[model samples]
Target chain A: MKEYLKRIYAMLIYLFLYAPILILIVFSFNASKSRGVWSGFTLHWYSELLKDRQILSALYNTILIAVLSALIATLIGTAAAIGIHNMKKLKKKVIMNLTYLPVVSPDIVTGLSLMILFVFVKLQLGFLSLLLAHITFNIPYVILSVLPKLKQLDKHLYEAALDLGATPLEAYRKVILPEIMPGVVTGMLLAFTLSLDDFVISFFTTGSGVSTLSITVYSMARRGINPKINAISTILFVTVLLLLIIVNIRMSGNHNKKER
Target chain B: MKSKWLSFPYLVWMLIFIFIPLLLVLYFSLTIRTPDGLVFSFDNFRRFFEPIYLKVFLRSVYLALISTVICLALGYPMAMILAGNNFKRKNVMVFLFVVPMWMNFLLRTYAWMTLLERQGLLNTFLTFLGLPPLNLLYTQEAVVLGMVYNFLPFMVLPIYSVLRKIDRQLIEAAADLGADQMTIFRRVIFPLSLPGVMSGITMVFMPAVTTFVISRLLGGGQFTLIGNLIEQQFLFVGDWHFGSAISMVMMVIILLSMGVLSRYDKEHEGGGLW
Candidate 1:
């Protein structure tokens, strides 16, 4: 009886979680524009979504920002992780705590503070400001991911590379970089995914003209019900799902390999 | 290869981006713009004490607290089930809990607008069952529901992870001592899971307290939470000083609550959100 009750409760929770999404998915396929009625199935909305220039541009901007931010953050953060890894205890503590600040603070605080900084500095609240904000928030995550791998790194590996007559830069490129490649990749992917989904900071930082996919969706949502929004979200939902699945499979594969 | 010089670019970047921006906010919050340019004053902080803003702050706290409670009530049992039980798809089940969170949260919140709208799913079901179509959206209840919906995973994942790490031997020892399931859970499981519970509360409460999107779309225009207030200050009203003050207060609330929770949480485990 208890087991049955638990199963039923789990079912209810899953239903609660997925019902809205499932409804949206189902509604996207409905021929009718209104959510209330389903007048047979059609790909009308998805096709409309394909042709929507505004959304496509938003999508373009989202990918562009995410990719650029992730690439830049990965480079800087990997280097910082290595540097901080070599630091004295007190200095490491201070820098690591600073790193945690953006992670721990509410998005609104970060968003508003960055907005003020941009205004004070006289930078326009557009692509550059948005990129700056993304990079700021993203570095901590990259550092956190990379720092652990640095901890796990063999201490003498770089010295061994240097002893072989390689220069300091070459030693880092050949030895240190390869050793932390997994962490770097993980951090970059994480930064990309976060930058892609981020809305709040982007909403505050982006000026009148700029819009990521999320910002566009927010406006479409606020403007009222549009079947096109439903279609767009469905595509986004599936894309994220697929990305996660691929990552999960790879992670499990790595876990298996490590066990071996 | 691990030279500290490598960190120079990053430190400079952080100073310009993260640290200095925060200091600028502080500078703005503590001073007012007068005829002589920026004059130091506590006027922004004082304005936050006004009843209207105070009410918004309280409502943000009240709703977040209620959402946190609801999440705990719903989430604790779910965590127990996930940890304490055996299932073929246990990992998959845990992953499902986090999957919704990974979906664009804005889209997820907007999805609620569909169901809670007048001719939406819930009302359609209600009307089919001969019930009155309720004014469900743009209300306090809707706001709380959205909060719970958005944050339930934040509560569950932490508690679930902590619960999973409880030593099985202790439970077995309790069973050997003639403790029933309920007693074992209360004495052994629940106590061990308190750290997770604390972290879970911190996770849920922080976001729930700071959310502007849910309250805006679901609670409608009239429902002004602290997040909305700060958003208006920066984006709409252009009152950076007042916004900075509000942001400072919010950070204090979050940090204080976290400190208190962590004080109770002796052995800090990895919080589940990461």
Candidate 2:
């Protein structure tokens, strides 16, 4: 009886979490615009969703920013993690705190301050600023994930590679890079997800002409409910679900390999 | 060694992006642009102390606190269950908990809008059941619901992780002693889980307090939380000094609370952003 009750409890929580999203997904296929009444199924909203120029551009912007920021943040963060791993105690602590500042602070402050800095420097607040903001927030996560892997690495592994007559760059590329590859990959994937989901920071940093899918959705949502958002969000949801599954599979595979 | 040169580039990037930008915000908050020249003053913060803005500040904190409490109440039991020794399919259950989080945050919150609309599913179900429909949307309850719904995962994930890490031996040993299940849980389990609970509170509270979107969407623009006030200062009024001042105040509130929380978090587990 106790076990049955536990199962029921878990089920109710899951129901609460998933029911709204499932409803929205179901509505995306509804032929009629009515939200409460489920009309006959049709793919009209998804079809309409594709032809919408503004949403398409926003989608393009979201993907472009997410991809570019993830790549750049991974590169910088991995290098910085290695360097920090070799640092003395005090210096490491200071750098870590500096790293945590952005991570810990509220998004509004980060967003607002970045806006002020961009305007002060006369940098345009469009795609470039948006990309910069994403990269800025992303690097800390990448650094954090990468640092743990660096700690696990055999500290002498690089020296061994060098003593074997490989140059420093070659040693780093062949030895250090592979060892931390899992962390780097996780960080990159996380960065991509965060950039994809980010709205508040993007809302402030992005200017009039260029907007992300989030910003577009916000404007549409503000005006009231639109079925088009449902269509776009469904596609986004599926994409993210697939990504998470791929990452999960890959990580578990790596774990099994490590066990072996 | 020489590899430390690699961090040089990142340090430079951090200085430009993190340090300077925050410094600029501080500068804006402290200074007023007069006709003659920019002058430093506390006028913005002074104005913030007025009752109208104070009410917004207090409301933001009060609502965020309520939401955090609700998340804790709901999430704690779920975490305990998932972390329990007899729990099977733990990994899958945890994964299921995370799956909704992978959905877009905006869409997740917006999902509630569909359910809470006057002509939406909740009312439809109510009518079908021969019950009175609720005017659910555009209310304080809706905003609090949105916060709890969105941030529930943040609370659960941290607490679940911490509970998972608690050694089973400790509980077994407590049982071997004179402790009952309730005693083992209260004396052994709960204390060990404080770190997770602390981090959970911070994670949920910070976001809930700062959120402008949830309040704006669910409150139907009727409620002006601190976030809305700050956004309006920048968006419409173009009042940077006042906006930046409010932002600074928000940061201090968060920082002070975090300091207090971390002081108690001796293990320092799961507090930092992952």
Candidate 3:
């Protein structure tokens, strides 16, 4: 009875976690305009999404910001991680806390601060500023994700590479890079995910002409909850779930191999 | 020589990007915007203590506190199970928990809108079961639900990390001594996991205190949190000074909580993020 109860509890929590998302997925295919009942399954909304210029443009904007922000964040974050890793005399704990500020700082603070910064500098509030703000937060995510790997790496591999007639650049390229590639990949993926999903900072920094998918979704949903929004949300939910599954499979496979 | 110059670029970036902007916010928080563009005054800080703004601040704290408790209630058992179970399905469970974090939070809250709105799925399902339709959206309840859903994984992940590191023999010894399951959990598991609980509470509470979008979108903008008030000051009212003050107040609350948690961790766990 105890075991049965525990199983039931687990199943119940799982259902609770997933039921809303699954409902959204199912209704995204409803044929009727009303969200009241289960209509016949149809691909109409998906097709409509393909032709909706504003939605497409917002998606385009999100992609643009995610790509640019992730790239910039990856570079800066990798450098910070390497620098912190090399600082043997410094207090590791204090540096870790400082590195965490960007991640843990309230988005409202980050957004407001960036907005005020751009205003003071007279920089135009648009894609570029959004890109800068996104990168700012994204850098810390990368740094934290990559730091553990850097800490675990063998220092003598680089030393050996240099001892074996390799230049500094070549030693780093041939030895250090491969050792840290897993963390780097994970960091880049995390940065990309964060940049794609961020709304508060984008809302504050986005100018008149550019807006992200999240902001567009917010405005549309706020005006009135509609089925079209469901359509977009369903697509987002499925895409994220699938991407995560693939990433996990790859990560777990690597982890299992290392354990063996 | 060139390597020495490399530090200059990073230092310049930090000063220009982070430090200067934060100092400006600090300055603005201590000033008032007048006809002369700006004046050094404490009016903005003083104004935050007014009843209406203070109520908003309290409401935000209350909401965050409630959400943190809920996340803990839901997250702890799950974390314990994940840490203790060497089952094949553990990866799948972990994947389920973390995958939701990848979806945009706004989109997830909007999904709640579909579920909770009048004439929406929940009400429709209710009517189908020979029951009356229930309107649940646009309430504090809905806002808290949105927050828990968004932050549960944050709570779970850290707790699980800490739980996984705990020595299994301790639990076995407790069981071998004939301690009941509940007692073992309370005496063994709970105390050991307090670090994660503190981290999780900090994680859930900080974001919950300042969350504007979920409350605005899911709570119908009726229940204003500190974050919503801050956003309103900047966007709708065009009062940057007031907004900066609210932002600073939030920063202080978060820093105080973090400081307390870190000090506690130092005394207890020898200091770690978990």
If scored against the real structure, what TM-score would every candidate get? 0.97, 0.96, 0.93
Per residue, candidate 1 scores C-alpha lDDT tens digits across B56-76 of: 999999999999999999999
Candidate 3 whole-model C-alpha lDDT, 0 to 1: 0.82
| Ranked candidates (DockQ, high to low) | 2, 1, 3
lDDT of 2 by residue, A1-260 (tens): 98888778888899989998999999989888878998799999988978999999999999999999999999999999989988999999999999999999998889989999999999999999999999999999999989988888887888899899999999999988998899899999989988998998999999968999999999999988989989988998998998898778878887888799
**Candidates sorted on lDDT, descending:** 2, 1, 3
Q: Candidate 3, clashing residue pairs?
A: none
Task: Please tell me which predicted candidate would have the highest DockQ against the true structure.
Answer: 2
- Write the residue-wise lDDT of candidate 3 on A1-260 in tens digits: 86566666667777877877777778889998777787799989888889999899999989888888888888877777776677645555666666677667788888888899999889999888889888888877887877788777887877788789999778767888787878787788878877877889899988877888888888898897767777888877776667666656766776787799
Model 1 per-residue lDDT tens digits across residues A157-253 = 8888888998998988888898788888888888988898899999888986888999999888887788898898899899888777776776677
lDDT by residue for model 2 (B201-259), tens: 99999999999999999999888899999899988899999999999999999999899
The list of candidate 3 runs beyond 4 A from truth reads: A91-95, B1-11, B271-274
Candidate number with the higher lDDT (1 or 3): 1
Kindly give the stretch of ten consecutive residues in candidate 1 chain B with the minimal lDDT sum: B265-274
In candidate 3, how many Å is residue B116 off?
Answer: 1.0
lDDT of each: 0.89, 0.91, 0.82
